[model samples]
Target: MTTETEAISDDALADVAYLSRSRNRITILEALRSGPHPSGRLEERTQASRSTLERILTELEERGWAERSPDGYVTTPVGERVIGEFRPVVTAMGSIRTLGEAVAWLPDEELSIGLHHFDDATVRRTTPNSPMAEATYLLELMREASVFRTLTYIAPPLSLLQSMRDSVVEGRMTATNVLTDDLVGYLRERPEQTPYWREYVEAGARIYCYRGHIPCNVFVVDETVLIANNDPDSGHPCEFIETTDETVRSWGRELIETYRRNSERLTPETFTEESRMSAEHTS
Candidate 1:
């Protein structure tokens, strides 16, 4: 006898493809969802030609997905179930099409987390009319959040950093900024900003640096997880995807931990010394 898993996989793949390939067919099924509709109505609702509608209806009938009676055609129970199951697939595909590289450019581990976690995410893409949309939104979140964390190669805006620093210094917020060692070294060369960074550490901000290539920027503020991407060539914001889903939040928390665990914790005194040395070396 054929194994159950082997038996279902072949049939299931065919069935899923059957329903997903043709928008006309899906439209016909959806149009018939509310009770029944005559052929003329189906053609109008599905925007399918008379011949095409007839052909799809025949296929649907053969598949037990629909039946015709005096009241035109009505969806079978199985058809209803199939459509319900298939709608999420459509939605997820739509999301993928819309997000494009914003999702694809994420690290390999992020893709392994699967696409379902992103189903509920909100994407803020940069537009010609609003080039700083993503950055502006992230800055707003930073100012409002009671907890802030990031794993990024990109340094945040100084104004936003100052806000977070003040909150942490005042004991009103908890914050961490995890960066690659290369980024930290570069920051040390900026004499004006170096002292401010050291002050950030002294004021209870958690800063960690490690050797690695950071591919994307992740910021978890309060209960939200925000992932951002920028164009590699122009350094312009590409998109920012934000979500408050518990699963994504859990993944974000674990991701921060992984980056931090591999990093060297920088104290205020050590950071100050490192900056001084870096400045000397640069001069």
Candidate 2:
């Protein structure tokens, strides 16, 4: 007695087994991503010999995925659907091995739930010697955004901090910055730069200090683009994932809001007092 749900599960398992059985078939399917191709062309692209290609093609046609067309062999609508369903799985398998310790910076629950939203995102990586590369890219994105929000686990590069201040000063962008307490302590140590941060406050950039730890860094620009960054302390190369996918954007926005809700607003007067007391303690 196979229920409808059980039938669907069986079909799905069969499809998975079929796809996993042959690397040659996978190559042919991926080659078809650009569009239809003649058997000869597919042979060249997939690097499968004629006999092997013909067998794969026959199997694909029987599966309702490949069809003979006036132009050549094209993937059918069913094939396209199958490819779409497998896209995130393919992307995850490709990227997961490279992510290293950076993967730990994201909440396990969030990653488990929404990691696929990152399938189409662009990743930027930086070497230890090039620590500021991703930050520079982020600044470029910020310059093009009218409104931006950031949830940061680490202090931003000084150059980027200055650029945000300049953008606020010039009335080019509005920003909301959420910071960990550790970053606030660092700012306190550099009292000389406190006035610039005050200017940032006056220029309409709001700051919030989260009472506890935030695992990753998120920047949402114009509510359209989201950038997720790993902690530099992770010992792996720093990396950032940028995406315009609306689902990913929403996820980033929600992460930012979570931090904001747990944070206390930081005003210039309060910040100055905090910095002064810290300076006194250190002196």
| TM-score, candidate number 2 | 0.65
Show model 1 residue runs off by greater than 4 Å. 1-12, 18-91, 278-283
> Any idea what lDDT model 2 has?
0.74
Candidate-wise lDDT, in order: 0.79, 0.74
Candidate 1's TM-score: 0.68
- Candidate 2: pairs in clash: none
What ranges in model 2 sit over 4 Å off? 1-14, 20-87, 94-105, 128-132, 223-229, 232-238, 273-275, 278-283
Distance from true position, residue 177, model 1, in Å?
1.9
lDDT of 2 by residue, 1-283 (tens): 9888766776888898898788888778766655888899988887889999999989999999878888788788888777767766766665554444435545675543445665556667777698777767777876777888888766655666777888899999998989887877777667666777888888889999987877767778885554455656554323666677787677777778877888998887645856669656876
Scanning candidate 1 in windows of ten residues, the lowest lDDT window is 230-239
Clashes of each: 0, 0
Model 2 per-residue lDDT at 248 = 68
